[model samples]
Target: MNLVLRASILLLVLAGAPATAFAQDASDPIGNILDQVGQPAPATPTPPLPVPAPRAPPPAVARPTPAPPVAAPYPYGPRPQIAAPYAPSSSTYAPPPPNLSPSLAEPVFVDEYDRTPDRPMNSAEQGYENRMRSSFAAAQGMQGPLDGAWTLRSDAGQAVYTLLLVDKNNGRLEGAWRDPRRPGSRDSSGFLAAIQKIGTQLTASFYPSPGAGAVTLTLTPLGNGEWTGELTEGGARLGVVMSRN
Candidate 1:
């Protein structure tokens, strides 16, 4: 047979051969030879180098503006530029008169009403005391310890009251009070009236001025040495005080 045909036939025979026929044997000379050569030592596989992961980008930041320094709050900055004295641009604005006289006959109510002692009572004077008492009570009741001293209030007009605890045996209910602020009030030519008390309230009647000279006081007891009073007279109201001696 030709060489090619011979080789082909040998391959075919090898392929069709039973595994046992080709099985390496411990006693085989070929295997013993290959063992000596160590089968060229299997080519060592190279481990792939570890590639570094790509890094993430850093976050963006805003840059601040360089601002001018601010002035201090007090006496803030440099002296402000003073404006020049203005020259008259036009004659539209005028100066006011030096003596702008007031109307003399403007019905003169205030002085006329205040000084007219001979003026008769007006209807508006009614219930004057009730209103005054109510106000006084509200004011005085808010405070302290009034033991023996009684309170007097006016019903018709503002009055200066002088309460003298009269000895009942002598039939005289006499008392005295002075304007604490005014050095000597009794020397002011004001007439005197007697003071009388009637159940939680005191009444004083003076000659001539009927109710005009009457004074009403609201007394409040403040546990300690203090007491408060609200006094009302005519359309006006005043405050008063009485201290126990």
Candidate 2:
């Protein structure tokens, strides 16, 4: 009985002890190293900063202009001549003739009569024509041909006349006259005569009456020893034809 009681007490002590102590235990070094390697590493921290945009360039400027130029001019002067000097001749210079003929010695009078509209030439007509013809003949027939000038007297109610004689030698006429009662003397009779010639024919430009008693005569010569004349501007039909004798 005392032995049994000691065994029972030992068994009670073993039952109360820890299971781990009672259970079986195992240890493996390789399995422990594999577990540590499988675990992940720690993360790294970040650093922050600002970024810049791109830039551009500058612009340019302008300038001014210039001007132009000019030019110049010219000049002038005088001249010269050819011949010599001469004097004016006297109006009375007579040209000498080389030959003489009896026919030329006889005076030639150029006279034309205009009858009053339709009336015929009368005794007064014959008287005037004869007188002028004779006068011209007398002036030229003599050794001293007709003078360049002479006087003539007439009545109030008579015929008119004109006489022109050209000296063939000088180509100039010494005596040229016109009367109121003559053809082509339509103007007044009391002034100097008007005569003009073209080629060989001559004309007496008229002289109008100047109401009062003013007598005028114009005698102008055409350069080639020819002449032109007229007498008018008054009431009387009287005048003279004298040379520069």
Candidate 3:
């Protein structure tokens, strides 16, 4: 109906218009009519497409930060060394000597006793005790048994010296003698040159001088804490007595 109305109006307009108007649109009369009628309403503006926000670059993949390298304490040449365990070499090993000294090389040992203990003194012991009391000078009773320091004197009471019988072990006796007149004088060493034991008598030889002959002394126990001894010096036998210090 609108088309019919529009056509009717167009016919009316054509009938009433001047030929000068018709000449202006003579070549495109239908097109001109339709163009005037087809003018569209103002188009509603289309919102711009979002463009998807560029996808945010896939969130940058969240790469992990690498740690800083550790600096070496001794970087250039010599590294720290670990100490190795001690190892003894075979070249330092030594074999001991065949025969070591008796004093040092001998391990400590105890000797067994063969005789009885505390037997009664024989008749010879009694006679010897009497001789010391009567004949030897400076003879006196001792408080205890004779074992350690004692003094040796001549029957005439001259040339006294100290005698130490402290080294008797296992029936083997060793002794040393010193002269107090000469301080620090090693008059006699305990290393006896010769010694013999017969019955209750002990014969010992002492080397007081390297070039001189040994001095011999024979000691007989007096059944007391002393010895009735004879000192033979230079082919002369002099009676002597030993008593506790």
Candidate 4:
């Protein structure tokens, strides 16, 4: 009975022991080991804090305006005038022959007689008339060897039945092609357009009324009252020689 009583007392003492005593007993061993190495006891582990979300990048900023490019100075100077397609020949067309005087080339104009009472001319009207006469005289004075009719023949010595007339006094040209074999058949005849003269060269443009395209002729004087030239039309080229008739 005494032994059972003693055992019951020991159980009661153990059951009544403070929790601090058990913790101290359990930590003593590790604490002693750390003390022996001169180190601090390890702290209890804590869960890692949630990582902070990355902050959004600041709004993009616009780039500054770049400076304008500077142009380089011209090495020589300002650009020069565009050159002519071809240099003008130094030789000029000769004056009209002595036989072809301005008086003989002047056009005659006949005015109808007015039956009404005659009126005195004013100063303005007289001045205009004088200017008109001066201009007419000047134009008539410019006519030269190119004023007469010309005949164009082929290498075979056959007449091409082509006739050309240049009226320098009126700045006009006309050409006609006919079929000599067929008495009254006419192929072409009209005034040439865009007549220009440069040195001894003459260029004339022609547009046939019934034809679909146009043609241009560039004629160069070959002296001796003759001219040689080329006609360009529709990508085709033809050689022509003309002599005064």
lDDT (tens digit, per residue) of candidate 3 on 1-245? 99999999999988878876767688778878887896877889999987765545555577789997765778564587879988777698554454442333323311112223334445777799678767533332322233456677888876556666633334555667665555544554344566656677877777665677778888888877678889886678889887876
Writing each residue's lDDT as its tens digit, candidate 1 over 48-84 gives 9999999989989889998999776556776666899
Query: Distance from true position, residue 203, model 3, in Å?
Result: 1.4
> Model 1: runs farther than 4 Å from truth?
1-164, 167-172, 184-186, 189-192, 205-213, 218-228
Model 2, residue 119: displacement in angstroms?
34
Among these predictions, the greatest lDDT belongs to 3
Clashing residue pairs, backbone N/CA/C < 3 A, model 4: none
Worst 10 residues of 2 by lDDT: 70-79
* Predicted structure 3: lDDT: 0.65
Model 1 Cα shift for residue 74 (angstroms): 99
What are the per-model C-alpha RMSD values against the true structure?
A: 22.3, 25.2, 21.1, 23.2
Taken over the whole model, the C-alpha lDDT of each candidate is: 0.50, 0.45, 0.65, 0.61
Report backbone clashes per prediction: 18, 22, 0, 0
> Candidate 1, overall lDDT?
0.50
